[model samples]
Target: MQLARIHHLLQVAILLAVMVLSIWLIGDVLMVVFAATLIAVILHNLAAMVERRTRLPYWLALSLVVVVLLAAIGGLGWSSGPAIAEQATRLRIALTTQAHSLRGQLNASTMGRTVLDYLPQSLGGNQAGGGDNGMGSRIAGSMTGVLSSAFGAAGTLAVILIAGLYFALSPALYVNGLLRLIPPGHRPAARTLLLVAGRTLWAWTAGQALDMLVVGILSGVGLWFIGVPLALALGVVAGMANFIPYIGAFIGAVPAILLGLSQGTREGLLVMALYAAIQFFEGNVMAPLIQRHAVQMPPGLTILSQTVFGTILGLPGLVLASPLTAALLAMMDRATPPLDEEDRV
Candidate 1:
């Protein structure tokens, strides 16, 4: 029996090692698959709503939901592109001018002079008559890489859309199929857990969408009120970045502050304060209330699980962590035997 146990442990170790290697090898494809799964979950709810409201068939309702989502995304991108581009150009020019002024200011400072003395000879005080051509070249290279990645992402999104459509149309077929793999007695429990997970995911999706809209509108309006250029662009960025939870708010703030600096220190301070306030309200008020009503998670465990899974899985892990944790918690609640009041006493 001990030898059999040792063999089982060795087999489990080998399987885990293989799983890790496979994940590393196909990380990009896995990301696309995970994205498709999340979209399918969201689309399932939308399709169900449409089916109930109208007399449309399941396929037709699913198609309509997909089409509407695609149209909304396309419209937003098309409408915002020109303005975002113009803002980006203005911001770039401002950054260049700011960098030159900053270089001069730093050079005049005591610490700057001390640092310059220790700098490598190649990058030292070599100021050409023209602007920072090296910086320009680096920026161009980065843009090219970004464009390439975007094209790759577009292809991945197409796959995800197709997969999501199929999943949304007849999700019961998928659920029934999965349930068949479990023991007969456990199937009911499995169904319950699945329902819990779906409900939790839907609630999370609704809350996140609302949060993004609020943050984007507030940031854009605040920036405009403060007379900062590119307010809309900055707002859009903040809204999208908010999808990543804790880290995203700070990342979104950097560009806003830099743009504010172009106007003056006062503008920068105002923008910073506004963003800070928005985040505070969203975190303290919105998140707690929504999560409490929708899907409750233990605070300390949620943060720790996010950190651990995020380290292992990167951005996708971070994005899916909350829902995944909620699902696990739901399963535990269902599977554990309840204690009788007598036993508790």
Candidate 2:
């Protein structure tokens, strides 16, 4: 009996060492894995819904979901690609001109001048690469870096899609394989908690997607009504940035505000107000309504988790922190018992 207990301890230690070493060795790869898992979970839920509605086989249902997603993406791109490209060009020109003008104004003011002096020379349009002729070289270097990053991103995305499809199609197979690694006595509880986490993630993703859509639509319409240039592009940026939580709206709004200011002070003010109002509604109304049906996280806890994860893993950490926290909360709920019935009443 003592020998068996010692052997079990050895096994546990070995597993722990392997896990820690794997994490230390390929942390970025783990980020891709976690992201793929989340996407797979969301796709699984959609595929399940499709299967129910159509009475299709599981694989067929999953394929149908993928097909629909690809079709929708293609349709949207085909319809709006030209307009977005044109607006993006105009936005770039407007932002560059406005940024230069703002830098000039800041350089002219007493306090602003001091701030600019202390700021990096790069902010003042001084190239770090040095010399007037180096501008062409700097641009070339930047283009190369951009192309490299684009290719890297494309490869990562392809990996994620393929992995997610596999997980979505054979989730139970993987889940069972995972369960086999646990002690027999604990597997039941682990399985139950896994289901809870899945439900929480599905609800969270659905709610967030809805929120993104609403914000994008409202922002686009609001900006268009106010005669803001490139409203569509700004709205799309707003929607995408909304994925990041607290600071996301502000990040999305900055470009719009800058572009609006390029037009006039009134336009800038109007754009700022529009974003503020939309954010207020989202925070006070939409979020609460969604959370009531989904996961209800304390704002402070959520923000704190985002900060810690962002520090550790950068963008992917910031993006996945909330859902991961939600999963942890679900596990805690499963592990902890409720108060006595009398106290509950």
Candidate 3:
């Protein structure tokens, strides 16, 4: 019996190793597919409600929901395109100017001169043919190659959309299939777990959407009032970044400050103050209210999970961390039974 148990342990370990390797190997596609599925799940309840209330066919309701979603995406993209383009142009110009100024300042200082002497050697590899420019070109080429490889999987977007539609349209079937894996006595409990997860996910999504809108509008308005160029674009970036929890606010601030600095020191200071206020409001007031209404995650656990998953999965990990954490909590709640009748009540 001991030998048999040891064999089972070894088998489990090998299986887990394989799973980890598979996840790492296909991390990019998996992230997009998971994101699509979660979005579909959030919209599932709305589609079902519309179908029932309007006495429309399931397919028709599904189509309506898809149309509305596509329209919203298109509208936002169309409206934001020009602002984003302008901001991109301005940001590039600002960064170039800053780099040149910094280089000049460095050249004037003894320490800077010493550092500059080593910079070219540090940047260039030992290859005789590869100078600094060649190294930079190679690095850029490698980045392009990596991006192309990551996105080159044929019809990936289509697959995600179709999978999302199917899941949204017939979530019950999926739930039933999952519940079938449980023991007979636990199937009901499994169903309850699914419901809890769905509710939590929906709540989290709603809160996130509201937070994004509020931040975006505030950032845009603040930038406009401060006379910062590319205010609209910066606002959009801030709003989008706000979805990622802790690190996002800082990332959004960098570009805003850079743009502000381009205007002058005074404008940069104003932008900094405005951004700080926005971060304060978001962290203290907005987050708590949203959490009360939606899924409540422990702040410490949220940060920890974000770090772990982000390390393994990159940007997508940060974006999906909260929802994934909520799902895990739901599972835990289901696994642990109530203490007593009083607790149940």
lDDT of 2 by residue, 1-345 (tens): 999999999999999899766644454567678788889999999999998999999899989999999999899889998898888888888888988899888878888777776775766733344565665444434323322355587887788889988999899999999999988999999999989988988988888888888899999999999999899999998998887677678878988999889889999999999999999999999999999998888889888988866655556667888888888798888889989979885
In angstroms, the error of model 1 at 264 is 1.6
Best by TM-score: 2
lDDT of 3 by residue, 75-189 (tens): 9779876768888787778766766776777778888877776665433322234555775554434333232366553554566677778888788888788788878997887
TM-score of each: 0.73, 0.82, 0.76
Error of 1 at 129 (Å): 32
Query: Which ranges of candidate 1 are over 4 A from the true structure?
Result: 1-28, 88-151, 183-185, 298-303, 337-345
Write down the lDDT of every candidate, Cα atoms only: 0.76, 0.83, 0.78
> Distance (Å) between predicted and true CA of 12, model 3?
8.1
Candidate that beats the other on TM-score, 1 or 2, i.e. the better one: 2
Runs of candidate 3 with Cα error greater than 4 angstroms are 1-22, 78-80, 96-150, 153-158, 181-186, 337-345
Q: How far is candidate 2 from the true structure (C-alpha RMSD, Å)?
A: 6.4
Give the local distance difference test score of model 3. Answer: 0.78
| lDDT accuracy of residue 226 in candidate 2 | 95
Model 1 over residues 1-345: C-alpha lDDT tens digits? 999999989988998899787655554456566567678889988888999999798788888988898899789779977888788787668766776776677689988867766664444543433345665444333333322366565765687888877777778898899899988997998899888777777777777788888888999999999999888878888998787566678867878887898789999899889999999988898888777767767767777777765655555566667667776787777778989989896
